[model samples]
Target: MSLPADLCERTLNRILAAHPDLVEQETPLASLTSPMSPAPVGSVRVFKGSAVAKVVYVGLVVPMIQLDSHMIFAFTPEDSAVPHFTLDSVYGGAYHAFHLDLIPRADLASHLPYLDAAFHPLSPVFESAAGIEGLTPAAIGPRQRAIMSPWMLVNRASEEAFAAITEHVDAYAAHWSGLVDKGLPDDVLAGLADTDLAARDTAVRANIFSRDVDPVWAQVSRLLGDETTDAIRAELVANG
Candidate 1:
């Protein structure tokens, strides 16, 4: 397996180990390789648990262009204030492009305490990974970045730099798992109503997976077709 794929599997296994209650949920569009592609190229899987509302994993391999992609999202309950977890990595022989972030449940600018409780702990790990050599900025635009946390790590890395990212991925995933288990402070929760929290989580997720916001969806559509791409987007954005 490729370095990125190896880390993705290990990180996902760690998440499952931390949350033993999580159960794999069936997906109708489990097979992502449609007639659009000549051969079997990808698959999608979903899981659900008490602490984690839903988890989606998608893996894609296009031998024609030497592309391998693995993406996962573990979203906490919509009514809870915990941030969601997401990890995406795509390796195309020469370059490794990956993005990792804890998607905030509420707007950080308005909720200082929530930000401090959830994302602040991740600052050191984010900064350390940023300093890795041979890591270049990813093509994600400013608009797309606004929806995710400031600590998001999205970059194109050299093989050496990509290998170095595994430790940071483990750190971020571990920290997120802790948040999912213990949750945010009571004071932080007091000000935010459950209804509002759910609303924001839904809206933020819709925007994050929206094709208009993220250009990568276009590329995904080309590989998976509009119907399949939309189905996957619906899964990511769905509240239930």
Candidate 2:
């Protein structure tokens, strides 16, 4: 398996082990093959649980385009204010890009308590990983970056640098698992109503998955067709 595939697998394993109650869900996208490629090109799987509304994992390898990618989106219950977990690693041609983030459920600027409680613990690891050699900023535009957390690590890296970030990735995943178990502090949750939390989560998710907000989906649509791409998006934003 490729380095990115291995990292994604291990991170997913950790999440599964931490939450044994998770139940796998059926998906129409279980097997993906495009006419552009001879063999299977991609696959999607979904899981649901008490803490998680839906967890979507996707793998795509297109030999024709020299693209290898693995990504996961673990969304929390709409009623809860817990942030979502997302990781995407792709190797295209000679370059490699990986994105790791805990998608924020609230506006960090206005909700200081939520921001601190949920993301402060990751600051050290985020900063340290940023200093790693051979890691340059990714091609993602500022518009797309604005929707995610500030702690997001999205960068193109050399082979060595890509391998070096595995530990940091594990650290981020571990912190997210802790968040799932302990949840937000009482002070933070007390300030927000469950209805408001669900509303914000829905709005944010809609924006994140919007093709106008994220151009990547356009590329996906071209490869997998609009119908299939929308199905994948629906799985990612499904409200359990």
lDDT to native, each model: 0.86, 0.87
The prediction achieving the highest TM-score against the true structure is 2
Winning candidate number (lDDT): 2
lDDT score, residue 34, model 2?
78
lDDT of 1 by residue, 28-94 (tens): 7777785656787888888888888888888888877788999999989888788889999889887
How many clashing residue pairs appear in each of the predictions shown?
A: 0, 0
Report the Cα lDDT for candidate 2: 0.87
What lDDT score goes with residue 22 in model 2? Answer: 81
What local lDDT score does residue 35 receive in model 1, on the 0 to 100 scale?
61
- Per-prediction TM-score to the true structure, in the order listed: 0.95, 0.96
Candidate 2, residue 9: the lDDT equals 88
Question: Could you report the Cα RMSD, in angstroms, for every candidate shown?
Answer: 1.5, 1.3
Pairs in clash, predicted candidate 2: none
